[model samples]
Target: MPSNVEIKAALRDMRYLTQRAKELSGTDGTVIRQQDTFFKVPAGRLKLRDFQDGTGQLIFYERPDTEGPKLSNYSITPTNDPQGLVKVLTDALGQVGQVKKERRLYMVGQTRVHVDSVEGLGDFMELEVVMEEHQSREEGVTIANQLMLELGVKEEDLIDGAYMDLLLKNQQNAHAP
Candidate 1:
């Protein structure tokens, strides 16, 4: 499985973050709109990510839902038939939840910086510092930490889980009261 040191945080302002990222990377970044349909799996989490460009990826990943940078092991398969896969997966595994976001993606070295506006949630940013096959976890963490500092991500804004987890929690809360 391919891995990365991942960190996610709630964003206070997208404009400030985007500017800071641009200053550091000097790239305008790629913008994408995505909708992820999650599935209930026995281990880890599975999602079929459909991009607005008519492409998609079937992603499965496992990681502890921790507040700081943590390791995530994942596998991804590109699929052209997103709608069909979504239906089949939903039918076989049962749907968990769906999350929609517009993302501004930037690359700094082997790291990917994602500035996202997630529907029904809020603004957020994620850092995925991809690791080489022989790379140590410490290397990925070090890179992620440095990028965090460069990007001005505060500790207080760090998040504990994925967007699906947070979205489901909010839904439960809404229905509870």
Candidate 2:
């Protein structure tokens, strides 16, 4: 399994954070529109990510739901038939939820900085420090923390769990009496 040290945070100021990220990374970055369909799984998370192009990926990942940087172990398999796979998976496992977002991707050293505008959830930022085979988890966490500082992300802005979890919570709240 490929692993990374990752953190998700609420974006207080997307303009400032994005500008800082561009200055640090020295690139204009790429914008990707994505829709992720999550399935009910017994363990971990299984989602089919559609890239809005002709390509997509089936991803399974496990990580602790913590407020700070944590290790995520994941596997990804690319597919040219995302729609077909989504149908099969939904039928077999049952669909849980979907998340649609426009993600701006920036590379700062080995870290992937994703500034995202998610539907219904507002804006957020994520830092993924791709871990090398020989690297320790501590090293990845250290790199993630440093990038957090550079990106102007405060500790209070950090969030636990994925966007799917947050969306589901919001849905439940909306229906509650």
Candidate 3:
């Protein structure tokens, strides 16, 4: 599995953060609207990312649900038939949750800085420091930490779970009358 050091946090100001990220980044960022549909799986978390350009990818990933940066191992499969896949997966594996967001992606060295406006969940930031096949997890974590500090991510705003998990929790609470 390919790996990266990842962190997620509550975003206070997307505009300010994006400007800071642009200043710190070497390349211009790309913004895209995304819809992530998660499905129940026997092992690992699975989701398909559907983009506005009709492109999609199925991702299966596993990472420790801990605050701060952690190593995430993942596999991705490109898909052309996302709608069909969603229908089949929903019937077979059951749909778990979904997240819709507008994401601004910026690359700082080998790390990806994400400023996202998530529907229902408000603003958020995520960092993914891509690791080389020969790279140690510690090295990736260090990169993530350095970038986090550079981008003004505070320790208190760190979160352990994915957006889908948070959305699911909110849904459960809403129905727990």
Candidate 4:
């Protein structure tokens, strides 16, 4: 696996290469989209037996706050688990529910956009533009701008973090009220 810095450099180079390819082909110039399915398990319950995909994306989970939100650390996800990981999670949570599947479309100059359907959380779309390298902040913003234009994503629709964070916030709000 590449270090963070190396990964970032590679991504930057990839973006540049993609742009050149588009220019040559006179294409609109966007990266091909990839899809990931997540089976969310309660924290601390993940294990080798619990995973089927063998691969995972470590997400920097976050929660909402006045200034925006705070990082809630990373969540490791198995890449592909067809053996009903969601069912296992629901059972662990002691809830008779279904798993949520999301299809995310990512482009070079845009926030990550996903069409998601949760068994209990309902159907929703989410957008997240990640900032990786220290030097690529400006470039990331520019890419986000272009993606917004191409994908018709609005500024107001931009989200701070993941669905789990939103769900936790709502639960807290309900308890408070």
| Winning model by lDDT | 2
Cα error, residue 27 of model 3, in Å, equals 4.0
lDDT of each: 0.93, 0.97, 0.90, 0.38
TM-score leader: 2
Model 4 lDDT, residue 72, Cα? 25
In model 2, which residue pairs have backbone atoms overlapping below 3 Å?
none
RMSD of 1: 0.8
| Candidate 2 vs candidate 4, lDDT winner | 2
Candidate 4 ranges beyond 4 A from true positions: 1-99, 104-113, 118-135
Model 1, 1-177: lDDT tens digits are 899999999998789899988877789998999999999999999999999667899999999999988999999999999989999999899999899999999999999999999999999999999999989999999999999988889989999989999999999999995
Worst ten in a row by lDDT for model 1: 17-26
Alpha carbon lDDT of residue 135, candidate 1?
90
Q: Write the per-residue lDDT of candidate 2 for residues 34-116, one digit (tens) a residue.
A: 99999999999999999988799999999999999999999999999999999999999999999999999999999999999
Task: Estimate, for each residue in 121-168, the C-alpha lDDT of model 4 and write its tens digit.
Answer: 444443345555453545644654554445444445445534444556
Which window of ten consecutive residues has the lowest lDDT sum in model 2?
144-153
Using all chains and alpha carbons, the TM-scores for the candidates as numbered come to 0.97, 0.99, 0.95, 0.41
The runs of at least 3 residues in candidate 2 whose Cα sits more than 4 Å from the true structure, single-residue gaps closed, are none
* C-alpha RMSD between model 3 and the true structure: 1.2
- lDDT per residue for candidate 3 within 1-177, as digits (tens), equals 799999999987777778889999965689889999999998789998888577889999999889999999999999888878888889999998789999999989888899999999999999999999889999998899988888888999999889988888889999998
Which pairs clash inside model 1? none
